[model samples]
Target: MNIQCPNCQSIRITTKDEGKKVGGVIGAIGGGIHGISGALKGSQVGRAVGSIAGPAGGAVGSVAGAILGCLIGAISGGVAGAKLGEIVDQRILDNYLCQSCGHSFSIICHAGHSEPKIVGANFFNLTD
Candidate 1:
Protein backbone atom coordinates (compact mmCIF):
# COMPACT_ATOMS: atom_id res chain seq x y z
CA MET A 1 0.00 0.00 0.00
CA ASN A 2 1.14 3.56 -0.79
CA ILE A 3 0.75 6.57 1.44
CA GLN A 4 -0.19 10.04 0.16
CA CYS A 5 2.09 12.87 1.01
CA PRO A 6 0.39 15.33 3.31
CA ASN A 7 2.16 18.32 1.86
CA CYS A 8 1.80 17.62 -1.88
CA GLN A 9 -0.93 15.02 -1.86
CA SER A 10 1.28 12.86 -4.07
CA ILE A 11 1.39 9.06 -3.85
CA ARG A 12 5.13 8.76 -4.46
CA ILE A 13 5.93 7.29 -1.06
CA THR A 14 7.93 4.15 -0.21
CA THR A 15 8.86 2.17 2.89
CA LYS A 16 12.42 2.51 4.19
CA ASP A 17 13.43 -1.16 4.65
CA GLU A 18 17.10 -0.22 4.62
CA GLY A 19 16.70 1.34 8.03
CA LYS A 20 15.42 -1.91 9.47
CA LYS A 21 18.33 -3.86 7.99
CA VAL A 22 20.81 -1.42 9.45
CA GLY A 23 19.12 -1.68 12.82
CA GLY A 24 19.43 -5.48 12.75
CA VAL A 25 23.13 -5.34 11.98
CA ILE A 26 23.70 -2.91 14.84
CA GLY A 27 21.77 -5.15 17.16
CA ALA A 28 23.91 -8.16 16.24
CA ILE A 29 27.09 -6.24 16.95
CA GLY A 30 25.80 -5.11 20.29
CA GLY A 31 24.83 -8.66 21.13
CA GLY A 32 28.30 -9.99 20.29
CA ILE A 33 29.92 -7.40 22.54
CA HIS A 34 27.64 -8.28 25.40
CA GLY A 35 28.38 -11.96 24.91
CA ILE A 36 32.13 -11.36 25.17
CA SER A 37 31.63 -9.32 28.32
CA GLY A 38 29.56 -12.07 29.89
CA ALA A 39 32.21 -14.67 29.07
CA LEU A 40 34.91 -12.59 30.69
CA LYS A 41 32.87 -12.14 33.86
CA GLY A 42 32.06 -15.84 34.06
CA SER A 43 35.71 -16.84 33.69
CA GLN A 44 36.73 -14.47 36.46
CA VAL A 45 34.23 -15.98 38.84
CA GLY A 46 35.34 -19.48 37.87
CA ARG A 47 38.97 -18.67 38.52
CA ALA A 48 38.15 -17.36 41.98
CA VAL A 49 36.30 -20.56 42.85
CA GLY A 50 39.06 -22.79 41.43
CA SER A 51 41.74 -20.97 43.45
CA ILE A 52 40.15 -22.25 46.66
CA ALA A 53 39.85 -25.84 45.42
CA GLY A 54 43.27 -26.54 43.79
CA PRO A 55 45.14 -26.46 40.49
CA ALA A 56 43.12 -29.20 38.75
CA GLY A 57 39.82 -27.93 40.10
CA GLY A 58 40.66 -24.39 39.09
CA ALA A 59 41.47 -25.40 35.53
CA VAL A 60 38.23 -27.34 35.12
CA GLY A 61 36.13 -24.64 36.76
CA SER A 62 37.57 -21.90 34.57
CA VAL A 63 36.78 -23.71 31.36
CA ALA A 64 33.28 -24.65 32.45
CA GLY A 65 32.53 -21.16 33.72
CA ALA A 66 33.70 -19.50 30.55
CA ILE A 67 31.55 -21.71 28.36
CA LEU A 68 28.43 -21.24 30.45
CA GLY A 69 28.96 -17.51 30.69
CA CYS A 70 29.45 -17.13 26.96
CA LEU A 71 26.23 -18.98 26.15
CA ILE A 72 24.06 -17.02 28.59
CA GLY A 73 25.56 -13.72 27.59
CA ALA A 74 25.14 -14.36 23.88
CA ILE A 75 21.47 -15.35 24.19
CA SER A 76 20.48 -12.48 26.44
CA GLY A 77 22.46 -9.94 24.49
CA GLY A 78 21.05 -11.09 21.18
CA VAL A 79 17.49 -10.87 22.46
CA ALA A 80 17.99 -7.43 24.00
CA GLY A 81 19.71 -6.12 20.90
CA ALA A 82 16.98 -7.46 18.60
CA LYS A 83 14.29 -5.82 20.72
CA LEU A 84 16.14 -2.50 20.72
CA GLY A 85 16.58 -2.64 16.98
CA GLU A 86 12.88 -3.29 16.45
CA ILE A 87 12.00 -0.30 18.63
CA VAL A 88 14.33 1.94 16.65
CA ASP A 89 12.96 0.66 13.38
CA GLN A 90 9.35 1.34 14.34
CA ARG A 91 9.76 4.65 16.15
CA ILE A 92 12.73 6.52 14.74
CA LEU A 93 13.68 4.97 11.43
CA ASP A 94 10.51 3.87 9.68
CA ASN A 95 9.21 6.81 7.68
CA TYR A 96 7.75 7.99 4.37
CA LEU A 97 9.47 10.84 2.59
CA CYS A 98 7.63 12.71 -0.09
CA GLN A 99 9.52 12.75 -3.36
CA SER A 100 7.51 15.63 -4.77
CA CYS A 101 7.64 18.14 -1.90
CA GLY A 102 10.54 16.82 0.17
CA HIS A 103 8.26 16.34 3.15
CA SER A 104 9.15 13.61 5.66
CA PHE A 105 6.57 12.05 7.95
CA SER A 106 5.29 8.96 9.75
CA ILE A 107 1.89 7.32 9.85
CA ILE A 108 0.07 6.16 12.95
CA CYS A 109 -2.61 3.55 12.47
CA HIS A 110 -5.32 2.89 15.00
CA ALA A 111 -7.01 -0.45 15.65
CA GLY A 112 -7.92 -2.37 12.52
CA HIS A 113 -6.04 0.23 10.45
CA SER A 114 -8.69 2.79 11.22
CA GLU A 115 -7.90 6.50 11.30
CA PRO A 116 -4.45 6.29 9.76
CA LYS A 117 -3.00 9.78 10.00
CA ILE A 118 0.23 11.57 9.18
CA VAL A 119 2.15 12.65 12.26
CA GLY A 120 4.30 15.58 11.23
CA ALA A 121 4.23 19.33 10.71
CA ASN A 122 2.72 18.89 7.26
CA PHE A 123 -0.35 17.39 8.83
CA PHE A 124 -0.83 19.54 11.93
CA ASN A 125 0.88 22.91 11.90
CA LEU A 126 -1.42 25.68 12.92
CA THR A 127 1.11 28.35 11.97
CA ASP A 128 1.12 27.15 8.40
Candidate 2:
Protein backbone atom coordinates (compact mmCIF):
# COMPACT_ATOMS: atom_id res chain seq x y z
CA MET A 1 0.00 0.00 0.00
CA ASN A 2 2.83 2.42 0.85
CA ILE A 3 5.60 2.52 -1.72
CA GLN A 4 8.53 4.87 -1.60
CA CYS A 5 9.25 6.49 -4.88
CA PRO A 6 12.75 5.75 -6.02
CA ASN A 7 13.11 9.23 -7.47
CA CYS A 8 11.69 11.59 -4.80
CA GLN A 9 11.17 9.34 -1.76
CA SER A 10 7.49 10.18 -1.75
CA ILE A 11 4.87 7.50 -1.19
CA ARG A 12 2.96 7.03 -4.40
CA ILE A 13 0.59 4.47 -5.82
CA THR A 14 2.08 1.43 -7.56
CA THR A 15 -0.12 0.19 -10.34
CA LYS A 16 -0.11 -3.32 -11.76
CA ASP A 17 -0.49 -1.99 -15.26
CA GLU A 18 2.74 -0.01 -15.35
CA GLY A 19 4.93 -2.67 -16.96
CA LYS A 20 2.55 -5.28 -18.31
CA LYS A 21 3.38 -4.60 -21.94
CA VAL A 22 7.11 -4.76 -21.38
CA GLY A 23 6.78 -8.02 -19.52
CA GLY A 24 4.79 -9.49 -22.37
CA VAL A 25 7.43 -8.38 -24.82
CA ILE A 26 10.10 -10.04 -22.75
CA GLY A 27 8.16 -13.29 -22.67
CA ALA A 28 7.62 -13.21 -26.41
CA ILE A 29 11.32 -12.78 -27.02
CA GLY A 30 12.14 -15.64 -24.73
CA GLY A 31 9.54 -17.88 -26.30
CA GLY A 32 10.88 -17.10 -29.76
CA ILE A 33 14.37 -18.06 -28.77
CA HIS A 34 13.12 -21.30 -27.35
CA GLY A 35 11.14 -22.04 -30.48
CA ILE A 36 14.15 -21.52 -32.70
CA SER A 37 16.29 -23.75 -30.58
CA GLY A 38 13.72 -26.49 -30.75
CA ALA A 39 13.36 -26.19 -34.49
CA LEU A 40 17.09 -26.36 -35.12
CA LYS A 41 17.66 -29.30 -32.86
CA GLY A 42 14.75 -31.18 -34.29
CA SER A 43 15.95 -30.66 -37.88
CA GLN A 44 19.45 -31.78 -37.09
CA VAL A 45 18.31 -34.94 -35.42
CA GLY A 46 15.78 -35.69 -38.12
CA ARG A 47 18.31 -35.30 -40.88
CA ALA A 48 20.84 -37.53 -39.18
CA VAL A 49 18.43 -40.42 -38.84
CA GLY A 50 16.16 -39.88 -41.80
CA SER A 51 18.55 -41.26 -44.44
CA ILE A 52 18.68 -44.63 -42.69
CA ALA A 53 14.97 -45.19 -42.13
CA GLY A 54 13.68 -44.99 -45.72
CA PRO A 55 10.29 -43.22 -46.18
CA ALA A 56 8.80 -44.43 -42.91
CA GLY A 57 11.98 -43.55 -41.08
CA GLY A 58 11.81 -40.04 -42.47
CA ALA A 59 8.32 -39.61 -41.09
CA VAL A 60 9.37 -41.04 -37.77
CA GLY A 61 12.40 -38.81 -37.76
CA SER A 62 10.25 -35.78 -38.34
CA VAL A 63 8.03 -36.66 -35.42
CA ALA A 64 10.99 -37.35 -33.19
CA GLY A 65 12.57 -34.09 -34.23
CA ALA A 66 9.43 -32.18 -33.39
CA ILE A 67 9.20 -33.73 -29.96
CA LEU A 68 12.80 -33.00 -29.18
CA GLY A 69 12.46 -29.47 -30.41
CA CYS A 70 9.34 -28.85 -28.34
CA LEU A 71 10.97 -30.22 -25.21
CA ILE A 72 13.98 -27.96 -25.47
CA GLY A 73 11.82 -25.00 -26.40
CA ALA A 74 9.61 -25.52 -23.36
CA ILE A 75 12.57 -25.62 -21.00
CA SER A 76 14.14 -22.47 -22.40
CA GLY A 77 10.75 -20.76 -22.51
CA GLY A 78 10.17 -21.49 -18.83
CA VAL A 79 13.38 -19.77 -17.79
CA ALA A 80 12.64 -16.78 -19.99
CA GLY A 81 9.09 -16.64 -18.62
CA ALA A 82 10.37 -16.45 -15.03
CA LYS A 83 12.89 -13.74 -15.81
CA LEU A 84 10.25 -11.72 -17.63
CA GLY A 85 7.85 -12.10 -14.72
CA GLU A 86 10.47 -10.81 -12.32
CA ILE A 87 11.21 -7.79 -14.49
CA VAL A 88 7.54 -6.90 -14.48
CA ASP A 89 7.11 -7.42 -10.74
CA GLN A 90 10.14 -5.38 -9.79
CA ARG A 91 10.63 -2.70 -12.40
CA ILE A 92 7.02 -2.03 -13.36
CA LEU A 93 4.43 -3.19 -10.82
CA ASP A 94 6.31 -2.41 -7.62
CA ASN A 95 7.70 1.12 -8.06
CA TYR A 96 5.93 3.71 -5.88
CA LEU A 97 6.34 6.94 -3.96
CA CYS A 98 5.82 7.58 -0.25
CA GLN A 99 4.29 10.89 0.89
CA SER A 100 4.41 10.39 4.69
CA CYS A 101 8.12 9.81 5.29
CA GLY A 102 9.55 10.90 1.94
CA HIS A 103 11.71 7.85 2.12
CA SER A 104 12.31 5.99 -1.11
CA PHE A 105 13.12 2.31 -0.90
CA SER A 106 12.58 -0.89 -2.79
CA ILE A 107 10.96 -4.00 -1.39
CA ILE A 108 12.61 -7.11 -2.73
CA CYS A 109 10.07 -9.35 -4.34
CA HIS A 110 10.58 -13.05 -5.08
CA ALA A 111 11.79 -12.13 -8.54
CA GLY A 112 14.00 -9.26 -7.36
CA HIS A 113 11.56 -6.41 -7.98
CA SER A 114 10.39 -3.95 -5.34
CA GLU A 115 6.96 -3.95 -3.79
CA PRO A 116 5.75 -2.27 -0.59
CA LYS A 117 5.60 -4.39 2.48
CA ILE A 118 4.57 -2.91 5.83
CA VAL A 119 7.91 -3.50 7.57
CA GLY A 120 11.15 -3.59 5.67
CA ALA A 121 14.22 -1.40 5.59
CA ASN A 122 14.05 1.40 3.08
CA PHE A 123 16.11 0.45 0.07
CA PHE A 124 17.54 3.93 -0.23
CA ASN A 125 17.96 5.77 3.05
CA LEU A 126 19.60 9.08 2.22
CA THR A 127 20.21 10.17 5.79
CA ASP A 128 21.35 6.83 7.12
Candidate 3:
Protein backbone atom coordinates (compact mmCIF):
# COMPACT_ATOMS: atom_id res chain seq x y z
CA MET A 1 0.00 0.00 0.00
CA ASN A 2 1.11 3.52 -0.79
CA ILE A 3 1.03 6.37 1.70
CA GLN A 4 0.17 9.78 0.32
CA CYS A 5 1.21 13.14 1.66
CA PRO A 6 -1.66 14.95 3.31
CA ASN A 7 -0.49 18.38 2.20
CA CYS A 8 0.10 17.79 -1.51
CA GLN A 9 -1.36 14.33 -2.13
CA SER A 10 2.04 13.08 -3.18
CA ILE A 11 2.89 9.38 -2.89
CA ARG A 12 6.58 10.03 -2.31
CA ILE A 13 7.42 9.31 1.33
CA THR A 14 10.50 8.56 3.42
CA THR A 15 11.01 6.55 6.56
CA LYS A 16 13.08 7.83 9.49
CA ASP A 17 15.87 5.26 9.61
CA GLU A 18 18.47 7.98 9.93
CA GLY A 19 16.82 9.07 13.14
CA LYS A 20 16.90 5.52 14.42
CA LYS A 21 20.58 5.16 13.65
CA VAL A 22 21.26 8.43 15.45
CA GLY A 23 19.27 7.28 18.42
CA GLY A 24 21.12 3.99 18.55
CA VAL A 25 24.47 5.73 18.44
CA ILE A 26 23.47 8.12 21.19
CA GLY A 27 22.16 5.29 23.32
CA ALA A 28 25.37 3.33 22.91
CA ILE A 29 27.46 6.29 23.97
CA GLY A 30 25.34 6.89 27.04
CA GLY A 31 25.48 3.24 27.89
CA GLY A 32 29.25 3.19 27.58
CA ILE A 33 29.56 6.10 29.95
CA HIS A 34 27.31 4.42 32.46
CA GLY A 35 29.31 1.24 32.15
CA ILE A 36 32.54 3.08 32.85
CA SER A 37 31.01 4.64 35.94
CA GLY A 38 29.85 1.30 37.18
CA ALA A 39 33.25 -0.24 36.63
CA LEU A 40 34.97 2.53 38.59
CA LYS A 41 32.57 2.13 41.49
CA GLY A 42 33.03 -1.61 41.54
CA SER A 43 36.81 -1.31 41.56
CA GLN A 44 36.75 1.10 44.52
CA VAL A 45 34.64 -1.27 46.54
CA GLY A 46 36.83 -4.22 45.69
CA ARG A 47 40.01 -2.35 46.63
CA ALA A 48 38.62 -1.47 50.03
CA VAL A 49 37.68 -5.07 50.75
CA GLY A 50 41.11 -6.33 49.66
CA SER A 51 42.97 -3.76 51.84
CA ILE A 52 41.34 -5.21 54.97
CA ALA A 53 42.70 -8.63 54.10
CA GLY A 54 46.33 -7.42 53.87
CA PRO A 55 48.57 -6.51 50.97
CA ALA A 56 48.45 -9.75 48.98
CA GLY A 57 44.75 -10.20 49.62
CA GLY A 58 44.08 -6.59 48.69
CA ALA A 59 45.86 -7.05 45.40
CA VAL A 60 43.86 -10.17 44.54
CA GLY A 61 40.60 -8.62 45.68
CA SER A 62 41.14 -5.48 43.62
CA VAL A 63 41.74 -7.45 40.45
CA ALA A 64 38.75 -9.71 41.04
CA GLY A 65 36.57 -6.77 41.90
CA ALA A 66 37.57 -4.86 38.78
CA ILE A 67 36.83 -7.85 36.55
CA LEU A 68 33.44 -8.45 38.12
CA GLY A 69 32.60 -4.78 37.97
CA CYS A 70 33.51 -4.54 34.30
CA LEU A 71 31.37 -7.56 33.42
CA ILE A 72 28.36 -6.25 35.31
CA GLY A 73 28.75 -2.80 33.84
CA ALA A 74 28.99 -4.08 30.29
CA ILE A 75 25.89 -6.24 30.65
CA SER A 76 23.78 -3.55 32.27
CA GLY A 77 24.94 -0.93 29.80
CA GLY A 78 24.14 -3.13 26.79
CA VAL A 79 20.62 -3.80 28.02
CA ALA A 80 19.98 -0.16 28.82
CA GLY A 81 21.31 0.91 25.43
CA ALA A 82 19.05 -1.54 23.61
CA LYS A 83 16.01 -0.27 25.50
CA LEU A 84 16.88 3.34 24.70
CA GLY A 85 17.35 2.50 21.04
CA GLU A 86 13.93 0.86 20.91
CA ILE A 87 12.33 3.85 22.57
CA VAL A 88 13.94 6.16 20.04
CA ASP A 89 12.80 3.95 17.19
CA GLN A 90 9.21 4.03 18.36
CA ARG A 91 8.97 7.67 19.34
CA ILE A 92 11.07 9.35 16.68
CA LEU A 93 12.26 7.00 13.97
CA ASP A 94 9.07 5.33 12.82
CA ASN A 95 7.54 8.35 11.16
CA TYR A 96 6.64 8.89 7.50
CA LEU A 97 7.52 12.24 6.02
CA CYS A 98 6.07 13.79 2.90
CA GLN A 99 8.75 14.50 0.31
CA SER A 100 6.69 16.90 -1.78
CA CYS A 101 5.32 19.43 0.71
CA GLY A 102 7.85 18.94 3.50
CA HIS A 103 5.10 17.81 5.85
CA SER A 104 5.82 15.28 8.59
CA PHE A 105 3.21 12.66 9.58
CA SER A 106 2.58 9.10 10.54
CA ILE A 107 0.50 6.14 9.37
CA ILE A 108 -1.73 4.61 12.01
CA CYS A 109 -3.92 1.53 11.95
CA HIS A 110 -6.86 0.77 14.19
CA ALA A 111 -7.26 -2.47 16.04
CA GLY A 112 -8.80 -5.40 14.11
CA HIS A 113 -8.13 -3.65 10.81
CA SER A 114 -5.25 -3.78 8.37
CA GLU A 115 -5.72 -0.51 6.51
CA PRO A 116 -3.55 2.35 7.67
CA LYS A 117 -4.75 5.93 8.07
CA ILE A 118 -2.88 9.20 7.78
CA VAL A 119 -2.84 11.70 10.61
CA GLY A 120 -1.44 15.23 11.07
CA ALA A 121 -3.61 16.81 8.43
CA ASN A 122 -6.04 19.69 8.85
CA PHE A 123 -8.82 18.08 6.85
CA PHE A 124 -11.51 20.42 8.13
CA ASN A 125 -9.50 23.50 7.12
CA LEU A 126 -8.05 22.44 3.81
CA THR A 127 -6.59 25.18 1.60
CA ASP A 128 -6.77 25.52 -2.18
Best lDDT among the predictions, by candidate number: 1
- How high is the lDDT of residue 11 in model 1? 81
Q: All models: lDDT? A: 0.65, 0.57, 0.63
Q: Candidate 3 — worst ten consecutive residues by lDDT sum? A: 119-128
Candidate 3, residues 39-83: lDDT per residue as tens digits?
A: 677677877898898888777777777777666655665666666
> How would you order the candidates by lDDT, starting with the best?
1, 3, 2
**Cα-based RMSD of candidate 2:** 7.4
Candidate 2 matches the true fold with a TM-score of 0.45
For model 2, how does the per-residue alpha-carbon lDDT over 1-128 read when each residue is reduced to its tens digit? 55445545445544443344454565556666667767777867896789597877877787788777776766666666666666665664443335554443445453334643343344345424
How many clashing residue pairs, candidate 3? 1
Instruction: Compute each candidate's TM-score over C-alphas.
Output: 0.48, 0.45, 0.49
Candidate 1 stretches with Cα past 4 Å from truth are 17-22, 37-83, 92-94, 109-112, 115-128
State residue 89's C-alpha deviation in candidate 3, in Å. Answer: 5.5
> In terms of TM-score, how similar is model 1 to the real structure?
0.48
For candidate 1, write residues 1-128 as lDDT tens digits: 54677777788876654555565566656666776777778788898898789888778788878888777765666566666665665566535667887766666432147545443544433323
